[model samples]
Target: MTAPNPSTHDQAARLVEAVNEALTPATSYRDASLLPAVGPTPPVPQPGRPPMSQRATDASALMLTAGLATAPPGLIAIGLLVASGYADPLVIGMICAAPAVIAVPVLAVARLLRGAQGIGAEHHHHYNGPVSQHTVHTETKTRGLFAKTINKQ
Candidate 1:
């Protein structure tokens, strides 16, 4: 047979080297020179979404919630102004009080969401890519009406 492709030959050689290395047991665990060099793991290639820090994410959530919490009071003030054609002091006071009543729970939700990192099983989305082989995929089977009747008989 003609000589194998150069690239294929190189790959075969590398594969054999790897297999030989794997098969050979370590002879000296106590020898410092024989041990593999320790270093920081090389970063995995993250193809999308620049990483957001926990603090940054928490801050963003807090700001968003704070803005949303202000909306109800703002809308109330606007409604009062439109109805009476003036910014009455009592109505303005009520508008200010509305936010205070709801602020605590809304802020608490933002805090909870921030602290919830790594709390639950990772939820897979369509963009998360193919499921790993280790994951279980469960499906329910249903029989057609005719098939069910035939099986029963």
Candidate 2:
């Protein structure tokens, strides 16, 4: 091979120097005590909706996990039963419709109860003679596990 070019050798030397400079730390000591103490990061607040409680979040996670874990096994069992001619059409239909049948009445009752809360007798106030009245109305709204109260005077 021919002799290496002087310019190429100089470029390689400059590149090696740059890499070495980049690898070297600005500070001499790598000890942890030399670094500034950092506190735990604060949680970022979400806008719009309020935060869910740990218990509610845990319950939801558990339900989701249980559903995921059980679905495949349940489906496999049903498939085996159907293939073996052990499950009849009527029994299969009932099994398919079971959740809807159980849910309908429960949902209806919940709706009825919720609707009943909005139905109430009107309040009538009558003042006789000269009277000054000051009224303060406080409204409390509960969503999930958190309650927010608003006072209006």
Candidate 3:
């Protein structure tokens, strides 16, 4: 069977419906204060690391990018010359094309690395990072089938 072809408005409406469903809280969970407290919160201690210097990072990145940019041209030249000795056009064509094809990804990666390096890794407090011993005490409503069997045994 062919897939249903939804119009742009239909797609948008479906998306809105899904968003509304997600935003609306469950009736049971509407009053969170009604639930009993679970055990004490788990401790999440931050691991300390020696701070890195931005100058050192930038220098290394510059050196790496320079090396990447030069390596491909040198390899392509050498590879074609070596492959030409085999007297195979197919081998020579493949060898010539391989470096050119790989060059795009290499440059993209170098650009990405440069951009990331430019945004110096200063410690920012990310939301999903370790939460201080704050417990959102909510208990599971039902036990697992295995859990019920285990308790009986």
Candidate 4:
């Protein structure tokens, strides 16, 4: 059967919305006061790591975006490899690992690019920093899934 006529972005949004909507609240507001949040509901100890499921989803999306696993441009490499009909197993192995090898550098460079783009590496308690020193509680604080650059003098 043909796929539904949904915009790519719309389709992704709908999928996420469905999963999020399906998440039943374990506690009512009143019950929350009497019980501690447990399981996946607890705050992440390390702010730089996305939740496991989200991380996997994000990786899949990245692969799709990078064209390593989709579309006309993506098929070019596969077509080249199969067309080559190389006798050397090493040559084929290199062809298969090529995507992953390139991906690592791309991801690394993306992180480096983020640094150039002024994304800080770590959370720090400073007057100019986001959280004030007095209010900085470790358990309550978290940041994004990227590196944190904390420059404490």
Q: Considering TM-score, where higher is better, how would the candidates rank from best to worst?
A: 2, 1, 4, 3
Per-residue alpha-carbon lDDT of candidate 4 for residues 1-153, written as tens digits (9 for 90 to 100): 987666987989999999987796655445445564566675647876555797797987787787754567646766676678744658667877998999999999989987785546987544665753444434424477885756444
Candidate 2 residue lDDT tens string, 1-153: 899999999999999999999999887755666654776877788895468998988888899999899989988988898999988978988988999999999999999988886646997779889988787666556577666655655
Please list all clashing residue pairs in model 2, or write none if there are none.
Answer: none
Error of 3 at 114 (Å): 34
Error of 1 at 85 (Å): 2.0
> Per-candidate TM vs. native?
0.26, 0.43, 0.24, 0.24
Instruction: Tell me how candidate 2 scores on lDDT.
Output: 0.85
Residue 3, candidate 2: alpha-carbon lDDT: 100
Superior by lDDT: candidate 1 or candidate 3: 1
- The reply for model 4, stretches above 4 Å from the true place, is 1-86, 117-153
Question: Once superposed on the true structure, which residue ranges of model 1 sit more than 4 Å away at CA?
Answer: 1-50, 87-153
25-134 in candidate 1: lDDT tens per residue?
Answer: 98877645765587688867698645789898888889999999998987886887878877777867786788787998999999999888774787755756776555
Of the two candidates 1 and 4, the one with more favorable lDDT, higher being better, is 1
- Candidate 3: clashing pairs of residues: none
